[model samples]
Target: MLDATLKAQLKAYLVHVRQPVELVASLDDDAKSNDTWELLNEIAELHPDVSAVRADDDQRRPSFLIRRVGTEVGVRFAGIPLGHEFTSLVLALLQVGGHPPKLSEEVLTAIRELPGDYSFETYFSLTCQNCPDLVQALNTMSVINPRIRHISIEGGLFREEIEARQIMSVPAVYLNGEPFAQGRMDVEQILAKLDTGAEARAAEKIAAKEPFDVLVVGGGPAGAAAAIYAARKGIHTGVVTERFGGQVLDTMAIENFISVQHTEGPKLVAQLEAHVAEYGVDVMALQRAQALVPSRSPGGLHELYLASGATLKARTVILSTGARWRSLGVPGEDAYRNKGVTYCPHCDGPLFKGKRVAVIGGGNSGVEAAIDLAGIVAHVTLLEFGDQLRADAVLQRKLRSLPNVTVLLNAQTTEVEGDGNKVTGLTYKDRTTGVVHSMGLEGVFVQIGLIPNTDWLRDTVALSTCGEIEVDQHGRTSVAGIFAAGDATTTPFKQIVIAMGEGSKASLAAFDHLIRLPAAGEAVAA
Candidate 1:
């Protein structure tokens, strides 16, 4: 069944249409034999304009295309509408129905006058929900203009294509057959790229530039630390980041970071930036590193290309891209995000102080959140989907000692209960008994795990099976000149203190490499 919220949004698209909307469910052979066919027939009969067409017969195939006419929207399920082909369906619908929200005159004019056709093909896995918004934003632009086309290929189904393209991560976008951008991009950036045509030319020019003494790939805590240290050593260093703060900006507060008893994530990031800036480190914000090209030089100088077509050469690179929160894929979880659903206990726990809350997961993060919340909240229900808590023995004992913490083992969160604005409770199923239960709570803290932001680096550096960048003790990657730190790297802990320490270490190593390099004018003496 279609979600009520999605259905309502779809209805909003039909305001200008005079003809009745038709929702056609295209069924396969299996669906025809099962009760799915009956359900489709029921829906078709209820709506006079709607039809359920079975693709079982050749004659019915024409009806599939016929129903698309005057239809403002179409939805696909089960079948793989991926790769270069998915763009066709979306374009057809947009052409037939027209844009519902409509674009501003300036945006529309800019899109129409876009000089050339630039197709961005992004390969993504279903696990990353964040990929969709990026793809959708691109598609929305594509809908408004004929020059730009966006394609999203599912990595799972199109394994061969993804492998051929050397895709290492979800939400990797390629522009005009070349790797153009990665990660999430805002609408304005997309428009600027489409309008300027400078990024494409810059990529070619950057390939010919000299490498830098040190290149920091992210501007987060780890990267900023590395940049400051490297710059202080008088090494020609540059920091390129999609955003200045990286994941630290997403955080609410930092209580565990040493020296600073308590600080917000953004505030901490600002301090790091200030420190780096004081050292005269070259910082590039709102820019993403497109690729890392290794130099033939023995001393480890490498070329770092940016999405905007700019390039920086460096003797050593420090990647402190950091990690993203792992989400619970259960229903209604997204609907209550920021309202009553939160990922960071340090960020949102205080809000639920003196109120009942549920912490989900069996790992160390889950146990830690529960133990911490026990001190502040009225009661904490620790729901572990595993047989037992996977935290360390000492932490498990501490959790058990807490009077207000209740541990529920082998419990899986099936759905998040919400009251439109905030979370009200949660529904879960017992793995052992097959019994389902619901509990009321003021908030839900998800502590499942963290996914390293190394997807974009797969083509440039080595990554572990767990998606972490593989690095040596000194924060050097398998590939020379490229270093990694923080949670994104193959470090033991995901703590801020550890990340900062690793950043410092990587910076020192980078500085050492820079000092050994030939001086600017003396290099040609050889």
Candidate 2:
């Protein structure tokens, strides 16, 4: 559909940049739109350094074609890049970038084999900046492959649709006519869900008959500790976890947890699980607690429903669900995570020994990670997107005294670059001067704050404005039968020791409450 002269020029431009280019057009014959094919041809001729091509006939009629010039990649969009359709460009670019992105092989294969056309609609708000990364990730997937499409609608723009879909929060994604996923999602996860949807539906139908007693949400230190204590008390305790070990599992080596001078996160989790298993704690992995409901009776009996349709009942509840690391949501950050990217310096810092690394964030965690890494890594670059470090003066002093650490204020991460399988470097832009520069690094650790896992409790329990469940000193939630602990609660310190301490206290409190209930019930019956 494109003019040969323009296509030739675009091909030349791509060659100049040494990247690939792709032109994607819609397949809907009845759909009215501009002549994207002709426009691409003209652009191709105008920018000969970039290559232009069309999707193969067998690949599907509505799909696009991708061609690599040298190293640079370009996309000629046949449709608006806004909304759900924008994902195409991101996918194409990722393909041109020579990385498969962060998708599982099985899911990727499934997506490749999918035929016809399907679209995903995600509803979100501008206030939810977190939603954009998810949108971009989906878009990237759609671009590389034609079977998938993504659309993001601003919640405000589609208020009626959002209400009808029951979208009470930001970042809710829907596939076809059914709700697919919500909140922050990576490409791999999205693909996996798509591939397993049928199986998941079948499993859900089967799990509806079973229920649990004392459902301990989360598998982090606090949740694990709670489950162990509850099981030891002879309560039928079960743990439903989206992922085992919560945030702590992502940690490399924890030196601060008392009694254990240095221990790997996974190892620690395994030990915890072993102890928990001794008491026969029912461990359910890869499941999330979607909601909690209190009994209609006066006495506090609660029910917990999981996303998988499994229901749980409890005389008393303990919420040890932890928090997650907040991301900068900038370009390349997600793509490079764990490749040349990391969230836990204590886990991955030593891996960068004798190599350059960057630590993004200026808070206490960032300062601490920088200080810790400076001693092991060859050179450490600390970037603060703010005007100054928010860490205490003592930590700031310690960071400043470190010879290997270089702190840059008002700096922002622009992109992460990698060499095929791993991270090679990153680019940072100066907020004040608007100048961008790239630095080679073996790794980049992101230490930006955390978000409590308390969104689902909004209606069931009282939560702080920041989404932390409010609890008494003894970790008792406002609800008489419900208790909370660790990072999920409004605790000041988020350390492992602190979380464990809270778990112990909450368990003791729950035991005391349980003890009182039976005696009072006997007296009432008499």
Candidate 3:
């Protein structure tokens, strides 16, 4: 099933495999084992350095052992790696065979201090963009310490185990049979789970923060950009976020960020965090900003409360809390999320290549997604709830031009029909005919609208009717010392380039506001 272009790319990447890697497939009586064996044999055919070896049912049931030719890190995949997760399988082999482990000293120390033997059973889907990150991080830990082990299980291939665990999402990590995390995670997050010391150190750092010059609320593209810009002004800036990457971590491929032709969401987020680390900004991660209390007096410090009961004071604040994808709220949609139902077309579209897929929504995003998926998938079915599509004329025209694309108007998606394993079809009601129909497809993409993360700031700042924070041209909100940017604000566009520009503007405006501040002594008395 590998295309020539993709095969070429795999060959190029395989050349860097310094040591021989073995794929020892332990087969069972299950039918899925055949599928797994087929995929592995195909992989072996493409790369001279990769060899597939089959084992009888007595050895183990449907597990692929991946290790260096001579050494064993005990790396095993319990499921077939398809879709976006194929990259994870490739990286796992390269990481195990190519180079020495390059984990930081702090992470290494935390691994060495593990209380006991820990194993991570990470359940994932081949189409899930976020699953590989957790799997790779956990795999690295296993390579460093023999006590730690991880098994990557593809949710589709191993349906029985996933159903037993009641898993409905990707990156569902279980530490020693106990649930650890459900979604995208970082190395520090995994470390914190392994030991309480990591969490304690983070809490201590957050509690020790005092008043600062600038405070950026979110840690997405806009917030990270704002923090870097503010710190460059030689001010003691602080950033409080639930996570360093914010919504960007949930995203997949980002093809349009300027200069860089192609990049994924996690890669871009890593770069953002790395760039922010170059400055002196106090980054308080894993803390959510719960409340905003304006300064009592002009030029005084504003008190920002976190969900952890910790309050941080800042002279100025920038709100860049990003937005989230709106769900269809249909039956089976939630149950099959990350199973065969995905929200990002750019990130997971490649996984559905040559497979029939459907895009739900008639807006610009839906049409755009349909157009994008048409090139990759065998067929694209676009469903619109309204009598007509809400997308722009130009986009609608472009969508109609694609031969493989089919648009259905006045179609209300009622339920996503899926087996216990993956999506089987889409069921929708035709408003015009009052008839419900099911279309067979392997994947479904939901592209309705973006819900801004501005509910928390409604009482503190001016918000649009749609719940986006209202900001002027200078990114200034109704509050004097507060500014907003990016998707959370009233910005017309929600692209990464636009968000970065907005962040730069907001930081510069915050700097300007600080320049007009009175002396420290006079500010307290005001």
Q: lDDT of each prediction vs. the true structure?
A: 0.68, 0.69, 0.83
In angstroms, give how far residue 202 of model 3 lies from its true place: 2.5
lDDT of 2 by residue, 1-526 (tens): 4346534643543443334454544344533223445545554555434334554354323334344454223233323333333333345444554545555575566667766666777665543324555766666666567567655565544455654654444566777878777555656556556565744753465366344446677888888888877777886677777866777665655898897889866568768877887988877666778898976643456888887676667777888889988877877777766455777664345345577999999998899889988887799999999998999999999999988889999998888888666678888999999999899887888888999988889999899999999999988998887888999899898998898788878877877777767543554444
Candidate 2 has its poorest 10 consecutive residues by lDDT at: 71-80
Decide which is better by TM-score, 1 or 3.
3
Tens digit per residue, CA lDDT, model 3, 1-526: 5678767877777777777888889987577788778878877887787899987655336778877788756578886676767777777777666655557697778777777888778877776778877888888778777788788887666667766765645678888889888777767778876676666676666768778899999999999999999999999998888887777787666778899999888779879988998996788777878899998677888888877677788899999989888889989998888777988776566556678999998998899899988988899999999989999999999999999999999999999988887888989999999999988998999999889987778799889899999999999999889998899998898889899999999999999999998877764432
Q: Between candidates 1 and 2, which one is better according to TM-score?
A: 2
Error of 1 at 327 (Å): 1.8
Evaluate model 1: give its TM-score.
0.52
lDDT of 3 at 299: 88
C-alpha root-mean-square deviation, candidate 2? 16.8
Candidate 2, residue 477: lDDT? 91
Compute each candidate's TM-score over C-alphas: 0.52, 0.54, 0.77
Ordered from best to worst TM-score, the candidate numbers read 3, 2, 1
Ranking by lDDT: 3, 2, 1
lDDT of candidate 1 over 28-81, digit per residue (tens) = 455333444554454445434445565654322112321334532333222233
